[model samples]
Target chain A: MTPPEPVETRTTTPAAGRSAQTATLAEIAREAGVSAPTVSKVLNGRADVAPATRSRVEELLRAHGYRRRRAEASRSPLIDLVFHELESAWALEVIRGVENVARGAGLSVVLSESAGRLTPGRTWADQVAARRPHGVILVLSGLDESQRALLTSRSIPFVVMDPAGDPGVDVPSIGATNWQGGLAATRHLIELGHTRIGAITGPSRMMCSRARVDGYRAALETAGLPVDPALIATGDFHHEAGYRQGLELLRRPDRPTAVFALNDLQALGLYEAARELGLRIPEDLSVVGFDDLPVARWVGPPLTSVRQPLTEMAEAAARLVLDLGREEAPVATRVELATSLVVRSSTAPPPA
Target chain B: MTPPEPVETRTTTPAAGRSAQTATLAEIAREAGVSAPTVSKVLNGRADVAPATRSRVEELLRAHGYRRRRAEASRSPLIDLVFHELESAWALEVIRGVENVARGAGLSVVLSESAGRLTPGRTWADQVAARRPHGVILVLSGLDESQRALLTSRSIPFVVMDPAGDPGVDVPSIGATNWQGGLAATRHLIELGHTRIGAITGPSRMMCSRARVDGYRAALETAGLPVDPALIATGDFHHEAGYRQGLELLRRPDRPTAVFALNDLQALGLYEAARELGLRIPEDLSVVGFDDLPVARWVGPPLTSVRQPLTEMAEAAARLVLDLGREEAPVATRVELATSLVVRSSTAPPPA
Candidate 1:
């Protein structure tokens, strides 16, 4: 195998630092001190571009290394999107967002899971290389060193969406404000006069889950409550995990009057657990969930949730991936969308 | 614009009938009176293939036109999986199944939608051709005459999964026993002593929706009950549509004691309509749904549903696409997986 080629952030080349922000065609033209169409002509090798101007633009192109159309007349207009799993609405929302952008660009989106694993297997990269897509998008996933080099070697730009882990300082990513979402969810319960609140955090290994837990802790500290390790329970972000951990939390002699689940699925599990325990929602135990998936609104009494702007996050991620694929494209190394509270019938003042 | 070439199936060329069924290298080898590996050597242009055997194999290859690997070692290994839309758990299940097979075959699955349209848009075929994937699988979708001809012309065999329209005599497809699913759902209700039953169906344009409704009517007739046109309401297979139509049926003083919904989302909408009207599931009314989606088991009273075997159908579709991409694959023009009834808490004998 070839020695790992030093990729974008590893080198001091102009293109390496271009990940700071995304630039447009006009910006590339202005930087090269030429008209936008002239730069376009040079990029497309139209012969009308002055040789001197062409060389100047060419140097800028290498420096910026923006997305260059491989072939305008006949190009494979497909982008590869890889996910850790496609078993939930979260993946669908991302697909919808990517499709919106891809359709407008006259491009097609091709989806793949990371081969039944949390990360793209080595073979996954090889298949991606085979497809030779214009770019790649990894959702809730990360790439190993070799996989990163493989994609980079082939010049296939990729964007990380809701990355499960820290994808490094160089990898461009789109995520929601998880910390704020957790904070808002906790504050809502506090505003409803609940102090002894329990929390169900998703798997700690995931960055978003950890961020939410941190936000919850921050809110409790701001309210002058000691952070209770006992009140924080761990879950895998699935309904069964929620039910199992929710039971552990609810059965306590000092059970909280309110609880915050890291995700809607877990909160739903709590609902079943509550029912099993004969607990009436809000009146006996208030609940708040995150992600605000469609089911949140239809559940009995509905659910109070932290809306993560999943669709918008996905759309932004799609845009980011498209931008990254452009030659001389300014790259935003990271982007985060806003998350807000969606209050519904699932929460209220603690029992008087 | 390039003139459309009259494609396979339209011509008497050997490649035309090749769409009849994909044959494998082994089959081609047998027909050519050579060993499988020897035939492979001929296709791969290995020097060892005897000249006489090579010519014979090549002739057989043209006759069968089995999946011709364009430079096997360097060929793009991506398979295209297109969807009408990706908004539901139904799509996710299919994705999961496709990924499972694609992984094992050392191929990656690329997903595309019909350019944000319900019908596979005209440009969709062009995009697939540009990618030149190993094969194509369409979920709950069909290709127009021109689209089919274009794919056939390019030797890009495609299999339709759960085709929404008649795929015709030439096109290969995979589908569930929708009529059987509907029959089972209705029979379950009837077995519970429901004579005054109603049905909510998906859009009539969808073949599955029509077959399901036909099954419902068949079940009612089998039980010696008149099928009331008033009780059969139209829906778009969505929650709001189900709620609106459910409300329409429930408002009648002669409302059904048991209602069969074509899908889980619509069934959930009926749950809401019942709640809004101060009714209870399996008490004031009984509900049966199709597509045992994950939400089916988690609802207030777990929904009794007709299992469409979406995952299995998807897996089968994935396998079919791979087979069509092989050298001498046996062609199965259409494949239908079985559908069965899943009894849960939502269905009970009609309240007296």
Candidate 2:
């Protein structure tokens, strides 16, 4: 944080001609035949400058006011956010949310993926510990006792985002209201006079998937209808899985009149399956999806879906992690954002 | 790295065991009432462990033959990959490429975005310096003199991918043949018997954008056709830009028989424009786009496009950066992957 060192002044020194008073580098741009930033780059000795341009700017600098000041706190304050994967719009949505908040706070966000492993490798923890980020956000990820201890011992706070598995009572977490979303979707179908409904749930082990299934049961129970095991199926939350599973559902002789897919990807797959079977959506069968990603609108019939506040939840998680690092910020154990039903073109009354 | 310290040898001493032979930890998982990873965690002494589970796993460890070995490396070797933005599928494709290679190499990939700025902020370089990654791969990004110097001083190598502007001759980089991609896309339009072809160009300042426009010109020249200056329009390489510009192009009294969009996003926008004008694709106006993104296949009446080898380019860039970090590896100045034309359902002979 010291003042810039003096440079070799030439015969064209501003002190001789222009008084050198109020000689900001930007003023020098007019005389240097370059942009102000180019002049600034020359002043700071940035190497990206072409050698010829460098000399011209340096010549102008010799006759003008140019000073380079050391930036306070040379070390950057960054947040480490790790996911199991990144090649999806869902991950992008979360990244946008974190970046929006981080940028406003003058902090940069760093992203990493654990290569789709069920648990992160020990090396990831080791690097995070060494980097000593201000805080960490684990998306659909959790730390084992050792990794948690490593970060805790370093006084670095971390939060779980949409925990894939139970993060336990002690871990701070942020998630959307999965059960409510599922309940709302099912109720919409029931209100449309659809009692024979089918469901495609995400991986049973994921907390959100389990809660959504639970919600489905809750809605059915509230309607005084017994849950049918035959009507429930499992999906891997992918288009291919949805297509295969949807085909299976459609092929059944007693197939339900409506299908509820847990995610848009799977619902799109169901659409493909329905097309192959010559069954039009909302005409012979009504379909609903969750997550309400942008693709929902792009699809042919525009699926009815449950809108999960993914971005808002991500923002909340990011803020919570940063707040946990602040001494005065009260830490909440759990945060649940709301989810609601978005009724679009895909759902209607079941077949006459 | 050092050998594991000797543990307490109370009742479960290995010397007092019934042949502590062939007792791998995986074997211990069956008897310990826990996962193999949990046993490994106990062995690693990670702090996130519950006392009860730790004790149970420890008992199984002592009863069976559980021994700890020194890990070859405590910290993961991470490579920094920076982008201008992550909200697009183009970014995701690059990520997938880098992750694919990094994972196989037993290295993790850390992602960062410069918030769409031409150059990353000073803190980004500081953080990378602090982390001391294996190397950095910047996509459509560059470093100023100081940031480059900081990395070079630390012996941290970096390579640019699809550089936005001319990288100094000294820099190693990987990119697709953008000019060729543009040439192919435009040539396809001409081959469709479209004499009055219009085009939407990407941002004029970007290197790829300029190259694509140049290719368009070259293609028209090769076909012995005069390039129309008024028929060419500039875009921000986004959907909205395409929609707005497409509308302008479509509204012209001498509207083109066909239009070539610079990217798939812009092509989708053209679809929107055509829809708004009640014009059917391939019948009223032909459209061809560059960057055969996945959406190109899914759009109504799939689009014909130039396929830039984005994933392969990214993989090459990642490997190049890592290679630059190796003391014995020779550096290549620049690497250009090939681009090809993918003809699908959207294109046809200019509205017959």
Candidate 3:
């Protein structure tokens, strides 16, 4: 590994020390025996500076290293990072991952939430466009047709993470294999001798939620187990929604012996519901979750979850967006990351 | 109670549906009988466009209800959010808090890391200044004089979070009362009838670690107990570090019956170390933690911890930075938020 480079501090530079208390344009003009506006024009690099005056000012700037600071400020680079929302802890890791890559690339990442006040209107687009970012990385939860159209219309090179649509408009995308992860989770429960398995999934409209639901169904069919519609419930991917669905599922006289939640937040809700219903995990009912976030290992009975390579995913997403900015032609690419099941204490054989 | 806002969507208006697909700049230009560049310039509000051309384009835009996709890219309304490092799930909540306030103010946040390639330099400052952000929020573990000088030289308004200096600096700051929280945690252990207490603290260089250590010392003195330097061990605020410290402390011949970890991550490490030592929480040893992160509740024995309002701190930081941007003069503001101790299963009396 390369040795960590030293951080450059402005104070250490000799030039900064000389101009530590440098005067303004008026002061410079007075010292140069010229008008303030003339000094301003010369400083701003505009034309019409007399040779004698320009030479004198140039000499002064060289003496003070004043021109170096102005030149440095003028050549600043811009980087923009877009997110669907910053409401969850998961986004934090993603932000860190992007920051790491951006910093490594010697770029500054401008953070924007597409779902925030700057909705896909001229106002929003204008505000973002004003930044003139070199590239943009969009962490989209889901984009409606208009938002997608608007983004495409701007012709800004962008990479999307967990995009809702096909991203056919030529933006690169990075996402986890939600369907396969879902299948593996459901299959794990089946292998553990669970016949009646239920699922609490996210909003069906989200591509990820739909993919997971599909995987759950496929697993049941592969095992020759009937896919019961009643056993499938939809949630907003929030703990409260999962808790509500969990309570409803447990209330059934013929309740499923196991449950697979699409996300850890939902799984936590299920745990709460299980506690309220006086049911013990694994012993009374087995539970599995996806997106084995940091809390998965800390949760009681350690949640058995499908771990998504979040850091890797974030790094890949950042790289994709940065690359997109550099490419002229629209590059439509999709990277599907693999997932693995972490078998913890949350899962066990069905109760006899 | 305020109703939750409706989620934004992008359905096209029925009247503009067909036109949106077929309409192009060429078509608009043809309709107005102007050249493509002229039409573009007029639409973009370039001063170079003749008044007549501008008027015509304005009329056509309103008449056709034309929705231009993205605006012409420029530079404005940018802000950089800098973090020292990213390691925990709790950082997500803080990011969300910042995003929330930033979005509301129509300012885009740029994410950057302090220790990476984008460290304080002409390059980093250039990158940030290129986008021309209104202000910046630096989320540092601590700030040395050199780092402070860098921001001052850049002439950018910034608000520091969890900083290590006197808030007498020219910038605003927001931080949790780590010292008070530490006091609360230690006092709780004292109230629980524990005479012998130990501590696992984070790196002493951090303001939080130092503050917490001070609080612990104050509590011990208040309880008329001699402060035992041997009973305290330093960790890197990570689980493994905490675990190692826990093992060392527990293995000591004069091991204290209770341990106060400066943060939840350390407490978790201590928990694991205790388990490895075949000791049950609150029975063999009681442990208290600071920063009652979400994982604190999920641990096997729910952690008794001091809760820092992370989200609130993040919001305040955002607000402070934005406020700084709007002001012409430098303002030094310091905000100290309070913390509370939550009693959970992890704490009890000393063993007989």
lDDT per model vs. reference: 0.77, 0.75, 0.70
**For model 3, what is the alpha-carbon lDDT of residue B343?**
94
Q: Which is the better candidate, 2 or 3, if ranked by TM-score?
A: 3
Q: How many backbone clashes does candidate 2 have?
A: 6
lDDT (Cα, tens digit) per residue for candidate 2, span A161-208: 989999987788999999999899999999998898889988887899
- Per residue, candidate 2 scores C-alpha lDDT tens digits across B1-352 of 1112232222222323246434566667667677776665554434456889966766655454443332223222677888877666788789888877887775666677798886788768856754556779998889987677556534567888888888877788898899998888888889888888889998776898899889989999999999999999889888888889999999999999888899888888888788789888888888888888766765556789999988999889888877766643555659888999999877888766
Against the correct fold, how does model 3 do in TM-score? 0.73
**In candidate 2, which residue pairs clash?**
A47-B145, A145-B47, A145-B48, A146-B46, A146-B47, A146-B48
Q: How high is the DockQ of candidate 1?
A: 0.26
Native-referenced Cα lDDT, model 1: 0.77
Backbone collision tally, model 1: 19
Candidate ranking (DockQ, best to worst): 1, 3, 2
Worst 10 residues of 3 chain B by lDDT: B1-10
* Top-down lDDT ranking: 1, 2, 3
Better of 1 and 3 by TM-score: 1
- Give the top-scoring candidate (lDDT): 1
Q: What share of the true interface contacts does each candidate keep?
A: 0.47, 0.21, 0.49
Q: Give the per-residue lDDT of model 3 (tens digit) for B127-205.
A: 5533445667767543444444333322346787877444454457898998999899999999989878999887766
lDDT-better candidate, 2 vs 3 = 2
Q: How does each model score on TM-score? A: 0.81, 0.72, 0.73
DockQ for candidate 2? 0.09
